[model samples]
Target: METEPLLLSTSDGVATVVINRPARKNAVTQAMWVDLAARANILSADPDVRVIVLRGMGDDFSAGADIGEFDTLRGDATSARAYEATNSAAFAALRNCTVPVIAAIRGICFGGGFGLAAACDLRIATADAQFAVPAARLGLAYPQDAMGDIVWAAGPQMARYLTYTAGRIDARAALSAGFLLEIVEAERFDARIGEIARTIAENAPLSVRASRAAIRAALSHDAEEAALAQAAGDATFLSDDYAEGRAAFAARRTPMFKGR
Candidate 1:
């Protein structure tokens, strides 16, 4: 089915979510934010989906939040709060998803766009991709969650540079800053992205999910406790996928994971 702001399709255990407002460089609207949150919720619950790939419909990933919405937000505290909540919810959906999310970035990834990319577990960008957070230019402050996401992906120093100057960085610089997993030339971007997605899909689903959960837990402050670490390790040991993996190794054949 088609939606106004987002287009979603699922096949071969992968869900593809495309931002559809290419005429405006896919600048996100309030409605679009709601749709994104909904889509994330749906994808997260789909047993058939092992991975999610987020991308823009046309040349650019997104220009940022639609400026036209600002007028409605100005001096309206309730409206502003609601908008922020919607955006935050959308980002949270991506972060909390059981399935891994990948950002396949192309042209511009700015402001909200950058935040979205940072929320994904992996990012594959074209050589021509450009990244920025232009809150400085707009005389606005980013929310703590957004700031934390940026810091997590690119480190404090890089996050500071991007937010302070509101300058654009090329794909290579983004990779160096740890904002992207890899950068491929535009001509080869699609093939490379597909290969990565297929590789992930071919893996045992339960193992992948457990790894994602463990990584997220380890990144959180609670992970500093020895008890939590031990608990997580024990859980992994008890998982059926772990048993299947060991058995497959002994059998000298590929293992099939049923996500048990």
Candidate 2:
């Protein structure tokens, strides 16, 4: 086991979270799920973090949750629900993160791993990446908390296909289904993720966050959330970063946002 099964590193306003079990294709353990939620919550609270990227070490992103623990952790309905609750917390943390979260995927991404990717704001996978949700194969139900993300990313029909068949789909198929933002060759995968993350990090943080909030609020159809999103968007115009953006536009120079 790694000293840190999940690793976090930050630079230039982008934080990378690594699932570090390459030998097992980075399958997440129950403890790792808890750690994932904690890390996401902590990073989201950090004003310095403009973006977050989730990936795995070595060739694969993740194969999904560790099945070996199922007999103990998810052996019965009571324990299964508890286990899924932990999974839901992790998914919710990523979905609700203030900064945009990107899933940098490659190799096999299945079951819970796919759920995590679906929860992200964006997904970029290698051309050879494979995806699936194998709950049916294991004779188990998919996590309910993550269902919305899968539906939102892949649409209802595709989500049904993934869930019902438990079949593997390639990156191109996922991209066509609206699950992936883009796909790159395996060799260029890391570079592409870096480019996108940097582009987001360089943008005005307040504006980016406001946009994210607004989009989510619109989808949620909750009046309170809509109002909050409106407030956030309105606040951005009065921020120092907004002033800098306007000044830079007038000066014909790039904006340096303070995220104020």
Candidate 3:
């Protein structure tokens, strides 16, 4: 079956976002980025989806933005800004989702692809996965807001290293550089991702949401960050799922969570 540039599918509380332009290594066009933002909005509003996963349709995750359209779409400052806005919005959407976002990477993930993966809450890669940031070579500037994802994922030093060198790094280097959470063999990658998605899907949504907030708080530097984090954690304690969790533990059975 031929896949669209991007595809969103939800099943059993898990939503998958697929970048499907494998003919060009999943190179995303401006339209695809807009669609990604729209899909992120849809996934966030969907209560049935407790988690979101991003992946590629074929071997390579993505080669980043489709440069073939650059002559027209990014030829001028106005068009360039507008074009980049779609990318920024897509990344922001992924970051803003309260539900955890996981990036399942298999092959080439560079430039914009690397940025998106860095924006995800978690990244799982296959042994063949490779990453790079080619802005330096192309004489382009990486925007400050978008830079946060790379900075947060790999630290300011590594971010600078990757950008300055513009060198491609394999899964082992990416993981060693703290860009990926786990790396599985290519043969077992799909199964491992499925297992992880199922485990997250089976958990209490309330707890998951609360935990996401708490983890995000670690990234905040605002004066009230502590208060906000505490409030979020406190709210979960009063949730119906919390009661169900206690009861289920007492009864020695699985608890059903409704995301309330």
Candidate 4:
């Protein structure tokens, strides 16, 4: 029997997290969610990792949850809430990581898979990628945390459209809904994602981190969110990377940032 199949590997300052259940189109099990959260934490704490790429094995990305377990694990509201706790841990770990995350999507992304992609910092998919949320069909109400993630990526309106309709959307429509940043041809997908990830990895880490935090707080009125965003900016101003960036600009040479 196959042991847990989630994979995390880091190389050249970039970390790649792969969902390895291609047989199910990477359908996520609760155990996989726990493993994902742990791996994300490990990646978050690694100073050498400048960027993260999230992907799935085989021809497609994830097809969402392993609904087969619902009868045993999520048969009721309390049980479902318990099941979603793992999802919250995994997605929140990815979202709250200081480093940038890129979701490299190739094929189907449905239900929870769509939620995961939306939580990432950027989503780039192939032209053939498809997305949907089937909450309506299942007669399930999205918990606040999951709904908040959809709202954060798309918006209140698009989130409602997706949840209420339980309809499939193509890559172009997903892009228009703010669910995807770019859609490349299938042949060009790998090269395109590598190019983008390299660009982010080579940039000043502090500035990029600050930009990410501030943008996350852009529409938030919460005091804690405001304070966190302010701290990200303030810390960047005092970072050694700030000094190196300035000197490198003046000297007209590529600045090597050590993420100081």
Candidate 5:
């Protein structure tokens, strides 16, 4: 598929979606958001795709949403709603995918870029990664779902601090805030991402999908939250992979899972 603002490549059961606009520091365009969401849906439906990696082209992950598009968003209420919907759809697609999504972040990850990373199941950032949410600086309200992700990763206090300050934080600070799963030096970023992706791909797809769903549900504010955990545990216990795992352990060999 030919997408103007993004590039999609699938190989070895991993689908990599790359933000392609290097000149604007990979700032997301409206069309790009729509296309990305569509591509994500397609990948989610494909059984052969076990994982997805989101990254940016050029040196930076993303500068943020394209400021140039603000004219359309600020023009009127209808335009604003449309614009917000596009971004929300893109985020929803990422969040709702069955397969795991990893954000391989390097350099600057700001505003909408940070939102994108927050949508992923895991984030592996480079030591030099810089993060910020400048909605306050721009006098714009952060989207609720985006804010929720921040609050879920970081605490409400840290989320508020980041939003209020609109200041950049380093990779270590992000990791400390619980936003990053791992941080690696720039020299090892690519190899580290590959290793992590390979590890995820080797797992049983059914268990991974169930785990992703349960984890997201547990993060929500539902009253019966423990049900999600119970469902996840039950699903794994009932899966054929569990038996294979035990058999392999007994045989002293690695088990091959078919995701059944």
Candidate 6:
């Protein structure tokens, strides 16, 4: 059976979201953005999902939004705003996922594609991957939410440089600028990401969620977010997983987390 442009699959507490439009270099269309948001939101609410890995099919991660649609979808201020809404919604879904979202990027990751990677909690890329934001060159502006993610990932200085210059940076440069967690050789990339995902999945779910929430709260410095993070952390202590964790530690066996 054929898959949609964006595909979601789950196994062993991990959900993998794939950008399936390899022919278009996985450049996302407006409809794909909507699908992405829906799928991500669903995954966020799924108790069985411990982590999410977002990646593109074939050689490239993504070249960014489908510019061919710009004439009809973003031709005017009103239409552009609408188009951006979908894009931001997709990014927000990934950003707000309860579990960590890792971007497994390869080859070209540019423009909105870069924003997508930024929205992820961590990014693992192939050594040959390239990153850029060509909004200026295209005479376009990134959505505010997307811009926030880019700035958060790259820091203000690096974000400014990329946006202003519209130049491409190699994987090493991206890693140095904080946009990537690490770069793996093309041959080992899939295996490395799978290992990382499985490692995360083996941990106590509540603990992972709490850590993510706490970190987000710390970074955002929002009172409400802090409260939410505190609540998540507090919940872990009362969870059955906590008991199992302690028991397994005492028994010197791996703890089997149930996400309770």
Clash count list over all predictions: 0, 0, 0, 0, 0, 0
Clashes of 1: 0
Query: Model 6: per-residue lDDT, tens digit, 35-133?
Result: 899999999999999999999999999999999999999999999999999999999999999999999999999998998999999999998899999
What is the lDDT, from 0 to 100, of the residue 113 in candidate 2?
A: 96
Which lDDT values do the candidates have, in the order given? 0.85, 0.94, 0.88, 0.86, 0.85, 0.93
lDDT of 5 by residue, 1-260 (tens): 22568888888788899998888889998888888899999999998899999999978898878889888665577887788788888888998888999999989899988888888889999888999999999887887887777787666877888899998899998999888999898888888888888788888777888788778777784656557656766788888988998899899998888776
Tens digits of per-residue lDDT for model 1 on 1-260? 12567888887888899999988999998888888988999999988899999999889998878888898763377777778888888888898888899999999999999999888999999888999999899887776787888999988999999999999999999999888899888889888878888788778776677677778777775644445446555676777878898999999988876666
Query: Which candidate do you rate higher for lDDT, 2 or 3?
Result: 2
Please report, as a residue range, the 10-residue window in candidate 5 with the lowest summed lDDT.
221-230
Model 1 global lDDT (CA atoms, 0 to 1)? 0.85
In model 5, state the lDDT of residue 165: 97
Compute the lDDT of residue 116 as modeled in candidate 3: 89
Q: Candidate 1: deviation at residue 88, Å?
A: 0.7
lDDT of 3 by residue, 1-260 (tens): 14578888889999999998888999889889999989998898889999999999889988998889889998888998898899899889998887899999989999999988988998999998989999898777776677998999988888998999998888998888888999998889989888898899899887887787777777866557667667878888888998999999999999988877
- Model 1 root mean square deviation, Cα atoms: 2.4
lDDT of 1 at 102: 94
Per-residue alpha-carbon lDDT of model 2 for 1-260, expressed as tens digits?
77789989999999999999998899999999999999999999999999999999998999999998999999999999999999999999999999999999989999999999999999999888999999999999988769999999899999999999999999999999999999898788888999999999999999999999998998789898899899999999899998999899999999999899
lDDT score of residue 54 within candidate 4: 97
TM-score of 3: 0.96
RMSD in Å for all candidates: 2.4, 0.8, 1.6, 1.5, 2.3, 1.3
Alpha carbon lDDT of residue 161, candidate 1?
Answer: 97
Q: Give the range where candidate 4 is weakest over 10 consecutive residues by summed lDDT.
A: 1-10
TM-score of every model?
0.91, 0.98, 0.96, 0.95, 0.92, 0.98
Model 2 TM-score relative to the real fold: 0.98
